[model samples]
Target: MFRRARFAVLFGVIFLVILRYYTTTRHSILDVTEGKTSGPWREEWGHPIKTKQSKGANDTVHDESDEYVNYLRVLHRKHGFTNDVPVATRRIKAKYSKPPLKARPSLAQVKNPLFKDPLGFTRARLDSDNIWLPAHAEIPPLSLPIARTGPRPSSIDASSLLFGISTTYARLTYANNALLSDWAAWLTDGRGSSNGAGLVLTLHGATESQVKTIRDELHHLGIDVTLTASAEGETDAGGRYAQLVQQMMRQRHREPDRKWFALVDDDVFFPCMGRLLSRLQKFDTSETHYVGVPSERADWVIDHGTAITYGGAAIFMTAPMLDTSGQLLCLQYTKTSGQTGLADEEDPGVGMAWDEGLSECLARNTPDIKMDVLPGLFSPTTANAQTNIDDVQRGGGYASGALPLALHRYRNYHRFEAGKGHAVTSACGEDCFLQRFLFKDGWVLVNGYTLTRYDGGVTAEKVTVQTPKKKSGGADSKGAVKPSERLRIVDAEDVNPKERYALSWKGKKKTWRLLDARVKENGEVWQAYVNRRGGGNTVGGDMDDRRPGDIVHHAEEEKSDVDSVILLIWEGEGEK
Candidate 1:
């Protein structure tokens, strides 16, 4: 009996020893403190580390960049919330009229996906400052009152000149209409959309029903826009852009007080129409003046053998220039594009962009006319030749002392399209968007862009106005000048220019990016600004981070389901 008992104890001891070994091994899987692991999951789960090899430095930088977008920052909190989320277009039951209907353009490509309820939120009133909102993605679509970006303009002066803009139905986005509505705040004089500046939208290939929807919607928002079907044979397909002046010339008799005919890309925004009107006033409208900013890309200028303007930078043609050059330029577009076989499949009737071929035609036809260069309007070329993304915009202090009248390519890299009106324009108007204001609390509010507090603190006057130095020339033309498949002269590189500016922002800085915004019936504006993450690289953003084979970085934690979001509430008119 004694021998048997002793044998049993020895067997028990060996079993315990084996169990401990397996348990310890299982625990090591969670131990990612050092990032070194045994299996083939190093590259996927491990952070890039520096090595002693020659290529190590470059590899580390490249790999680290790839990982920066690995974790997507979200707009929710982990704890203390019930599911009572607010409606995006909430209005009082009485005295609310429904706005017209237009499709909301999706900006999914530029921004990260927002994960909404299924999760809940704590109920709160939007009565004061620091109002933490429910998940922005959770807010429902418009139901009552007008969900347009801002208050409807009481008056718009359509008698001045027709402001023409062109875009395809397939390519129209939420940002497009948002910008159209925003024009009331900047371009229109007095209250609602004014007749001083009429808007003409040439929607290419859109169905009759689609055109009506957009027309009715803008009219309901108090914007009197002229909607024309720009099909191949009609005003559009590319002919409309070249012949817009001719079309507007017919209406000139009705709008006898009209001055200049301006054509801009759908993406361009006029911060203050007064500022632009002031600029145009400097030149002679009677003369054949072709005024515009040159293409920020130098290579395109070199290749074309002359300076060409990008439409997004806003192309203004004097009354005489447009009236004289209109029809001829359209014919030239057809003749030139057909000869070069540069007919675009999407824009079937037209050959190339009207800006390029039309500008070239204007030059050849009117040899005496030269481009009247507009300085300090568009953002200067990037400081470094290697980097892309130009514009005087740095952390919301737009064009500083340059006295900017317009802003372009906001959706390109900065993803500012989603934030455009909601960010600053809704509360302060376009003039206030991205403008910097320093508070006595050592905090700085860059309008709709960022709300930050520097380490030591920054002063308003100390924020000196500086501009990017122009490069010596377009991309080096050395070595055979390989013919590219497309005519793209320059494009924004993968790197975000906001990241470049982040270096100059001293101490701990937080970018309160606009997540969602809504205007109440009483004229109050509610804006949600959330911390940004996933610089367009995160993989499992909407899903739980605890999935298999996906490892969170050492700095990231699953402690909460979401990051904190900041909400700002502006009092409506007469609410005080």
Candidate 2:
């Protein structure tokens, strides 16, 4: 029985030892996969080191079993216990010289099944096993290369430019109308004109005199004036006026050669002809088909009349823009359809509507043709014509003034008259009519001073006076003083030739003298001398026995000698 019991005990001890060894090996494998293992079990720096078991103890122990077990577990996880792992290890030939630095496969190689398959399958294996190979090829080539190009040239003809003018009936009066005629003539003459650009006179009604004057003036200036008379006897209402003007423009466009047309009013004036031509010349007819002189109408106060459009009186239209065929649709759209409320009283005149209408038409039909408002090119003078009482008071007043560049509410009777009763100096006369118009259109009315007079309507008369003065003895008056010979004392200093003058007294000499005297008179000069220290007495007594403050006269003497001199003196006590 004792022998059997000892055998059982031995068997149990062997089983327990085997169980502990298996658990230890499994634990080591877990530690290595979880990155908790040290020494050879780690990815790099795998060599094991000897160390003391406790913090300060001098004792040490061999840990080769633990390290060896960890290494075997790592090998099992990486190589799946395959004979290939052992063969790969032998082929690489692990050496004590740095263990090959544990090189990682490149992305290309790792992505390729032949080198990177975790199952150890090569490209040949994929092919034989009917597995689809993934592709890593470059993207398909792009279609083709395109070449770059430069901007295209403008199709506009700079030679054939046209301009138009806008104005009301009343503003173009006699003087203003004449001024406009003169301006047109100047422009046509090419001396101070728009370089021979075609001139067109657009008016509300064609008066016989206005037409004749404008025609003659424009003819003289060398401008071919096309007088576009408004439809006769038509009432100014609704879009009818604008429509009629558009129709007229369409008719004018029939002539394909007419390049540009400028919109001008009868009251508009041009100050510098060179500046006007320069502005018209720089116009980009190719790109911007419609251009105008911008004007401010919101703040514009027409004291004598009504405010017109916000745009200046002048507008220039290119030839191509007048080609109505291209803008037919846009024009049709602009035409009122069944009483659209958008067409209100604010709608500009027919010509103005045509100008603005062309902008919208070109924008929609021919977008390439831009619309620009030239800066500082035209000025609206009508805005300046709305003068207040204060302006007249400060400026003294005006008479027969030059016509403004433009004018509002101009009447035919406002012309300057020498004897007319209505000659109150204000800005609203016929003179400012043209000035105001041209000013509103951005065409600066330069030389404004040359156009009008500052003072007018006043008259004057001539008068003569004589005064007696003491004269030197003549041949007929031996001992008898010749009744204080008559002398003429003229008030020549009244003109105030010198802006300022000074008077001083010499205390030491008891005398006073005039300095820088600009005297012009027919009389003898005698200065008043006073001796203030001698009891307020007067010195340099005169022959007339005049008091100190009394007038002393000197007259022309016929005698050759006798010291023909006279002096005047005054006495004062507090002259110090």
> Against the true structure, whose TM-score is highest?
1
Backbone clash numbers for all candidates listed: 23, 65
TM-score of each: 0.55, 0.31
> lDDT value for candidate 2?
0.28
User: Per-prediction RMSD in angstroms?
Assistant: 18.0, 50.6
- lDDT tens string, model 1, 220-273? 555557788765444333465665555676766677677777777766666545
TM-score between model 1 and native: 0.55
Model 2: per-residue Cα lDDT over 1-576, one tens digit each: 999999999999999999986664221111211122221100232344333333213212234323322333333343223222111000000011122112111000011111121211112111121212112111121111111110001111223534444443443343233344334322432222344445445555667766666566555544555665554434232223244335446645565565555554443334233333444566555443555443222212232222223234445566545544234554442332421112324643332334344444444566554444442211222112223222222221121122122222111112111111111001111111112101111111111111110111111121121122323432121111121111111111111111111111222111111100000122111121111111111111231222232211112111121111111111111001
How high is the CA lDDT of each candidate model?
0.42, 0.28
Best by lDDT: 1
